[model samples]
Target: MKVDWSPLKHELGEWRAAGLTLPLWWRDDDAVAPTESLARLESLSATSGVPVHMAVIPRDATRSLADDLSDQFIPVVHGWAHVNNQTEGKKAEFGMGRDAHAARLDLQQSMARMRDLFGARLAPMFVPPWNRFDAALLPTLAEFGIDALSTYLPRQTATPIAGVTQINTHIDPIFWRGTRGLVPPDDLVAQTVALLQARRTGMQDNAEPLGYLTHHLVHDADIWEFSQQFMQEMCDGPVRLYRHDTKGFS
Candidate 1:
């Protein structure tokens, strides 16, 4: 299958040599339609030398694509079933600012379950559903064998958890509306450019890895092209793409 990599591997290697890395973490392996989108992203990302992180859930009510990309990027657990049992106004409450103890227990089991199934290939990173989480869950998450937690919010707690890690993205390309499918194209592009600029002007810190979230099924032709171009331009000298492992990153 063919893939669409924005800034190819050759350039990525160059960026690595220069000490700047753009860690691109893609979420949503549990979407209703996972086959075509996930496959296309994996094919494209692998070809371009971009490390795509796949978040898998045991029972997504659909096929599991984790085992399919053994030759491609790394795999992590997005969440079990990617389901949100949070309250009506707070659907994506995996990590907000409440329920420390319960969240810990919930994640503990998820971690063990994922390890039993995925083995060492599973990195200890957790991306909550809806790309939204509560801030109060991080420190507690650390105790549940979570090495890193990835979220879509730009602001996170400053408290440190010795060995645990944290990664997040400010720009989300996927479109969503009140738990709906995907959003429109123009809105996605606008968000993309805004985040790209945020990274360029140092609005986003160097310590925190940059993020871009995608849902391949929402492939509106115009938005895809714009996304491709926006990322390409953002990847020039001032912009670099790199990935950092939980333990490896300082």
Candidate 2:
């Protein structure tokens, strides 16, 4: 389906007129090992000049995956394992139903395993599985050397706790509950326009880099095309790409 990107383009133009720069970042989750799909993602990032932050699952991550990472790919922890610990409700590894002590141990182990695999390449960020994390675990994140927390939607505050920074993805192209393919192009474009409008009009936190979330392993042709187009537009627009080290999260 053809997408009308004029709305997003107009919003970007407004940002330029205001002499504002939109901070943008890309994150792809659930990476375990090297695969053809992953190679495509890496190639896209290298070609588009937009770095992708790979949310590598600690338990399933491999040394080869770490070796496959280029400067364009940044590795961050994506929970202990992608397993859902909840007996009821939605899937989540770090949900409220989990025991606090067990959760802490999981967090500790997740960091250790990721550090072992990725070494110093791993960013000090935690992305809870299914983007669901218990608020009670917030304070303990810093103890495990986590500097940032990422999830879905706009973050309510820059700092949910004293030491950790909260940065979240505002747009996800997938229709997870539906066909597991791309969401309707019109809806996706409209959502992007709305998000940018909110930030441009001072209704949202513009400081938090606008994040593009993707699942490379599950992406089909449509999703890949949309991702490339969207990344190209953002790269060509008034924006600054976010970098973990230079962003002061450390």
Candidate 3:
């Protein structure tokens, strides 16, 4: 699983020469409680100096999790229940086949629960389960006090709605459809290079942070090791860290 990484290093070098910085961030989803894997993840983040946005499912989230979180972590809402209400398609908590009124109720309740559990620790961001959500629900996010939306792939628009911004992850190390192990490191590195190159050339939104996504609860040893190495390498390059307050880019 050794990756060449030369292409990415070279591209980063170009950015350094131009005095430009690559905005970088990390997000890990489906956290409801503390576990050994989460402890390891926190350790890795401490070592790499990259803060992790822990996407917590509100219905299952506990106050103990909020207490355990350090300054290096940001807790964001991960959907109402993480339940797949769809009958015959990709699993989704906020997708089609669900009644809009019911969905809004779920969201409202989730917001209340999360606020009670996490208090001021919660970031006003919503991450739909399975990276799938109904587009029709975008306008309603601000009504529930959500300020941002996160999903897979590059974001199509920075602000899907006036008050809510969108920022998405581009690189996921796990091969979910396969072994769910770390994807071939070489392939992952190549994809990272291409994604950065697109931004450098203005083919994509350069303002958006290059995001790395993970699911710590399911990480095998190989995935954990790969994540550590990949994150360390990214930090070694000309990368600027992104915080929730990062303006304009969301």
Count clashes in each candidate, considering only residues at least 3 apart in sequence or on different chains: 11, 0, 0
The candidates, ranked best first by lDDT, are: 2, 3, 1
Worst 10 residues of 2 by lDDT: 241-250
Mind giving the per-residue lDDT tens digits that candidate 2 earns over 134-245? 9899977998889999999999999998899998998899999999999998898899889988998999999998999999999999999999988888777898888665
In order of appearance, the predictions have TM-scores of 0.70, 0.97, 0.95
Poorest stretch of ten by lDDT in candidate 1? 1-10
Clashing pairs in 3: none
Summarize candidate 3's per-residue lDDT along 162-209 as a digit string, tens digits: 999888899999999999888988889899999988888889997888
lDDT of 1 by residue, 51-170 (tens): 666666644423244445554556676666666766666677474553666666667777776776567777777778777766566666677667777766664542346665667766
| Candidate 2 backbone clash number | 0
Best by TM-score: 2
Could you tell which candidate, 1 or 3, scores higher by TM-score? 3
Q: How far in Å is the alpha carbon of 106 misplaced in model 3? A: 1.0
Please report how far candidate 1 places residue 30 from its true position, in Å: 2.8
Global lDDT scores for all candidate models: 0.57, 0.90, 0.87
